[model samples]
Target: MGRNVLVVSTVDHADDTLRARIGDDVDEVRVVVPVVQQGFMDWLANDERAATHAEEEAARLEEELPAVSDARKGEADVLLAIQDALATFDADEIVVALRPDDETQFAERIAQEDLRPSVAGVPVRAVVIHEQG
Candidate 1:
């Protein structure tokens, strides 16, 4: 059977890289991002003080012609759902695409997760990509 590869990336740009590396070897490419949902919920479920703060920031950014905070609740939700999806999908291998500099730190975070050890038992590969100057 072909390898079921899980590609965990912090940014969507990694999708291109995954397509390149995954060429023929991987039968499927699943993306995992683990922060998107929690951040949005924490922002959305704000108490009076926090909501006011967010509104002020949003206004300030707009007045300054800065970018608006786009609603990425879905992305965040997907990120927070990583472990669950991993179990559900039964991926044979995990290919973590990280910047070379942050590769160690990212791996460390995964190792620290409660579910990581069991998941690690199934082959996990970390693919670090060097950044261009």
Candidate 2:
């Protein structure tokens, strides 16, 4: 029998082919998505004036968008969350399916961590799923 596998997804969308492959596996598979806080959602959906201002601010920081300290902290938090979620499941592997063009920081974070040891022996494979045209 196949071992359990967990899929961490930043987006709800997964292509049909990949989904089919996942379903074909005999082991259990679970998909986990990060929840956007209400405040963050509101910021994203702000009025035209606010949205423009926010965009301008972000653009201004493009040169140094993610400082090393901040990036490390975010990755650590994600690692902990992933650990907690996998705590109860008997997973033999973890497949992280992230969008190629996503602006979210999940992919970068996971790529920086040591998956095998962090997962307590469960092998982890990070797969970047680029959207098909």
Candidate 3:
């Protein structure tokens, strides 16, 4: 048995980057791609486009990372998604990938400070990665 890590990110995690952040002894990795609703209108529209993008991103990550135990769509809010995942996925650690702070402040913008309180006990690692071009 090994440690199970939960990866919550908005971008496609490259192999090197993922390895660097996740470190060693990761027996299982469950990925959660957060659906980011663009605007209030998108939210009112049920965020169909956002949901589609999230699923596509999750699928891409799943294909890119063969060792991944599971990959699925998560809520628009990253914190909520982590909480939701923790309910079902037994995660020993959590790695959150986010855009740089200087980047646009989207709804999903989260830092280690805000994340730590939401998920107590479970250690969290946040990586500042640029969004894929």
Per-model lDDT: 0.44, 0.44, 0.74
RMSD of 1: 10.8
Candidate 2 residue pairs in clash (backbone atoms < 3 Å): none
TM-score for all predictions? 0.48, 0.51, 0.82
- Candidate 2's C-alpha runs over 4 A off are 15-17, 20-23, 36-77, 101-118, 131-133
Tens digit per residue, CA lDDT, model 1, 1-133: 5666665543324445655665566555455543421233453563344334434432332232211122111122323344555665667766555454453333324432433423535655555565544
Error of 1 at 103 (Å): 9.4
In candidate 1, the residue pairs with backbone N, CA or C atoms under 3 Å apart (3 or more residues apart, or in different chains) clash, namely 33-79, 34-79, 36-76, 37-76, 37-77
Q: List clash counts for every candidate, in order.
A: 5, 0, 0
Residue 60 in candidate 3, Cα distance off native in Å: 1.0
Q: What lDDT tens digits, residue by residue, belong to model 2 across residues 1-133?
A: 6556665543324434335444554355544433221134343463344334333432332223221111111112335545765776666676655555454444334433444533676766666666555
Report the candidate with higher TM-score, 2 versus 3.
3
Find the number of clashing residue pairs for candidate 1.
5
Best by lDDT: 3
Model 1 alpha-carbon drift over 4 Å, by segment:
36-82, 102-120
* Superposition-based RMSD of candidate 3 using all C-alpha atoms, in angstroms: 2.7
